[model samples]
Structures are given as C-alpha cells and as structure tokens.
Target: MDDPVTFARKLRREQTLPERRFWGLVRPWREAGLHWRRQAPIGPYVVDFVCKARNLIVEIDGDTHYSEAGLAHDESRTAYLAERGHRVLRFTNSEVTQGGEGVYTVLMGVLGEPGAER
Candidate 1:
C-alpha cells in the first residue's frame, strides 16, 4: 500500500461525487473557525472529512461499506478513532446527494453552530 499521506492526497483528487458535494457544503464553515480537511489521514485510515479542532470525522458510505467485511472494518476503525477521542459520523452517499440540507443541519448541531444560516 502507498503511504497514508500519499494515498490521502490521491483520494482528495479522486473524490466521489458525494464527497465533492459535502466538501463544498462544509468549506464555508472555516469562516466560523471550524476548518475541515478532505481525504485526511488518521492513523492507517483515510477519513473522508475531518475537523481536527472538533475531533470529528465524517465518513460518506457507499455500497461497499454495507458488506460484511466492510462492516467489520468500519467497526474496528470507529473503535480505534473513538479510543483516540474522535467522534465519527457516517452518512450514506444517497443521504448527501438527496438530503444535503438535512445533513448540514445535523453537522451544524454537532459542531455547536446550530444557528448558522444554511
């Protein structure tokens, strides 16, 4: 496998459609002091999005994530992250593509910026 940093860089360039959309949606949050990173490396995993200041990691799940092996992997990953004091939020690709506003609303609450105008 490639180095985590190098793999993360590649992921940033080859973002899924949902990733691109979610990144765009959250990019403006930096003005609120909630900076975000896309395709960021955390230990051995490359998370879809993360806000280090908040210790939050957001994952966009695709079909592969619903598989048996995938579920196990995610469980371990989530546990590893939790042990390190990071909160993980997983959303399906369809959720982002179809219910982006709702997802944003939830994220604002998690980030303690509930009053942020969408």
Candidate 2:
C-alpha cells in the first residue's frame, strides 16, 4: 500500500478540473456543517472526496472510468467502503463541470438539504 502522506501529496499536486470545480462549489456547504477531506485515505484505497461528517465518499470519474477494468476497480472500492459503513456517490467529470447547478442540486439532495441552494 502507498503511504497516506505520499498519496495525499500526489493528489494535491494532480487535482483534475472536475475535482477543483467540485471543491470550490462545495466549500460553502462544507463551511456550513459538512466537513470534507480531499484524497482521503480509507484503508488501502484513497477516495477522491470524503465527508467524514456524513460518512460519505464522492468520486468524480473521468472518461477512463467507462472502461471495464475501471468499473471493476470501482466496484471493489465501493464494496470496501460499504463494508466500513460509508456511502459512495459517483459523478462523471462532465456532469460535475458542465452541469454545475445540477451537480450541486444532487449533492444537496444527498446531504439531505433538498431545498437549500448552495
């Protein structure tokens, strides 16, 4: 397994556009009550986004994720998180970046604040 520190450092240096956009848009909600950690280490897997408060992990998948191998890997990762009592929410990169408002709405729904606009 890779070192947690190293993994976090690498993630910090290589954040994708969707990751950055999501982070920026979610900052306010995080400040309000939801605490989130980017590239969080959970056992051997490093989640893209994790909200410890809600025990939820949000993953933004790029085009590569549509591949069979990527789907298998994601399934395994999701199972691990599920076993540990964490809910995983996946979003495509296009959905997050291109559909910013829609993405925020979905996230707000998941957060149990349906009417609250971010």
TM-score of every candidate? 0.91, 0.89
Please, what are the lDDT tens digits per residue for candidate 2 over residues 1-118? 4598688779978999999999987887777776788998888888899988778899999988889999999999899999999999999998889958887888778785633544
Could you tell me which 10 consecutive residues in candidate 2 have the lowest summed lDDT?
Answer: 109-118
Task: Give the number of the best model, judged by lDDT.
Answer: 1
Runs in model 1 deviating more than 4 A are 114-118
- Whole-structure CA lDDT of model 1: 0.88
Q: In every candidate, how many clashes are there? A: 0, 0
Cα deviation at 66, candidate 1, in Å, is 0.1
Per-residue CA lDDT of model 1 for 75-104, tens digit only, reads 999999999999999999998998599889
